[model samples]
Target: MYMLVDCSNCRTPLQLPPGAKSIRCAICNAITLIAEPRAVAPPPASSYHHQQQYPPPAPWPSPYQTPGGPPPSAHGRKRALIVGISYKYSRHELKGCINDAKCMKYLLVNHFKFPESSILMLTEEETDPLRIPTKHNIRMAMYWLVQGCQQGDSLVFHYSGHGSQQRNYTGDEVDGYDETLCPLDFETQGMIVDDEINATIVRPLPRGVKLHAIIDACHSGTVLDLPFLCRMDRSGQYVWEDHRPRSGVWKGTSGGEVISFSGCDDDQTSADTSALSRVTSTGAMTYCFIQAIERGHAATYGSMLNSMRSTIRNDLGSGGGGGVVTSLITMLLTGGSLTGGFVQEPQLTACETFDVYAKPFSL
Candidate 1:
């Protein structure tokens, strides 16, 4: 007899073929396993005739369970990929990128409770060739981050490096340019564009999964190509601007939740400076992002964003003449321009629209 089962991923009901132990859901393409019924206590004497006439339906197997599964945990599995490219020996070499990677890894392991084995780091200090932040390795690492993700999974992708833009030929970008991340070998391999980044990590995300990206790079406002970009002014009034492509391409997640916090807007460049800290130089955005979380200012998304902006603005200062000079000097040194006396406002983008104040910020 045929058996009815639900898809493991999408929960669509399907009919299992006779004698088949498993079946694949056509809608979500997830395989459902059929299990044999286990013996149970017989019904009471009063209902014995009814039980015999109609047997109880078999129970659906748990997707995460096995014949003898491991003990349950307090939370779902968490994974992260932290990449910091210093570009040693090159004119574009950065000092604080590797430090950012180390700090981020520590925060994830200590504060967020992510397993050390599950966190992947790619930086210039790594001796392992596979761990080096090359164009190919970063791509592979992105795939590894979301591989086998399931319900209740929390994933993070953090990049601290140079970012640039190329003209958008696909018409997907509203500004006619594609944001890009500069890998260590980007000079030779070409920069990894935002389209590819979205396809790799953003598109395949299934429902019930959450991805948060921290991008401390130039022109990274929409690095992940999320559909809604939050436009908030100093007054704290905000509106969600729709950025859907006119090409009819879908940039939103596949029922999953994705939120990105970037260093600056698409037209602006992020700062790499020693001004924010006396101990070491770091990406302005990364420093403030960590500070907001560690210092207990991140109760909600709106609060965290406001805190980051306030810190950056106060530390960098603001003046018309000084801002122009700072921008010129920054361009000469880093090959990018800054705005408002080295001010780099953090931006928030997401796959869907929600009230930032109401949604509590979590890993």
Candidate 2:
């Protein structure tokens, strides 16, 4: 006798054969565990009289099992690691990083339904020493985020802090520069380079899993070393430019999906400013990203990116009005400007190319 069950990830109905312990969903390829069948009494004649006959359940093999072997159980899980380094009492200190982490946590818990216990946060204000956003601690947290990840899992990594670029010695970087994330003790411990970041979080992902990285920092574009970068113009026309290394190195996921959103291009610097929210300083990119989602403008990836860029442009005086003059003055007073120019554009990179306008955006 076969037992009826639902796929753990896609919720597709499946029939488990006798003696089968686990089976893979034919639709989503997600592995699901099967419980032993229990005896139940048949329905009464009146109950059957009102029911229509149904087709027999489709036969799907238990890929994990052999003729007489037991199979292991697997289920998808969601996890996140959020790191915000304020570099307190230092020359490179930031005012809004910790606040960014807190806001992100709130959004994930309240909006996305990520369990509080599954989300790990590291910030300057954390009371636990292990939770401090130090170089070692951050690396370990990255490992933990993807550790034990299986097919159908969803993972996220969010960083709001200082980011920089270092000269790339390897032939992997097309522009000959590697992006980096600055930890609290970066001056002593050295910044986390893009190569290491990719190796740690991006490359190990398996098929049917997905990762979304939100980086609100300067020089963060391509920070995860994803292979394709989505280049869009002000008119919303876009193309996915190939960014694979000429050295033939693989910087993509292991059949899983990886997408990244950053504050600016590799050559530009992001602003830490109070212009976006007049009340307190915040990473401009972080502010706009949350706003895009909260305001119901993030139906697709293209829409989300466009909304973020438009908000930043208008807030920074590019839209043309008396409001522009006011924004310019406010930004100048706050010492918030991109290095080469006042422009800061958010960037998107991914392991694979897809239709940004057609693909629905989700965490």
Most accurate candidate by TM-score: 1
Model 1 lDDT per residue over 1-363, tens place: 345465565443355667888976543446788854322221222331121111111121222232465754534778888999988899998867876787788788878988676688899888877688987678667766766676788999999999999998878888999999999999877788887788768877777889999999999999998899999999778999999899667787767799999999999998865433233456778867887886688999998898888767864445222211132123223322222356678999999999988899999
Write one digit per residue (lDDT tens) for candidate 2, span 1-363: 557676675444455767888987544467898754433322232332233322211222212223554433465566789998888889998877876787777777777877676788889888877688987678667766766577787898999999999999867887999999999988877798998788767877777889999999999999999999999999999999998999777788767799999999999988765433334456778767877887788999999999888877875435322122223223323433321124789999999999999999988
Give the TM-score of each candidate.
Answer: 0.74, 0.73
Clashes of 2: 0
Residue runs of model 2 more than 4 Å from their true location after superposition:
1-74, 275-279, 316-342
User: Mind sharing the TM-score for model 1?
Assistant: 0.74
User: Which residue pairs clash within candidate 1?
Assistant: none
TM-score of 2: 0.73
Candidate 1, residue 102: CA error in Å? Answer: 0.9
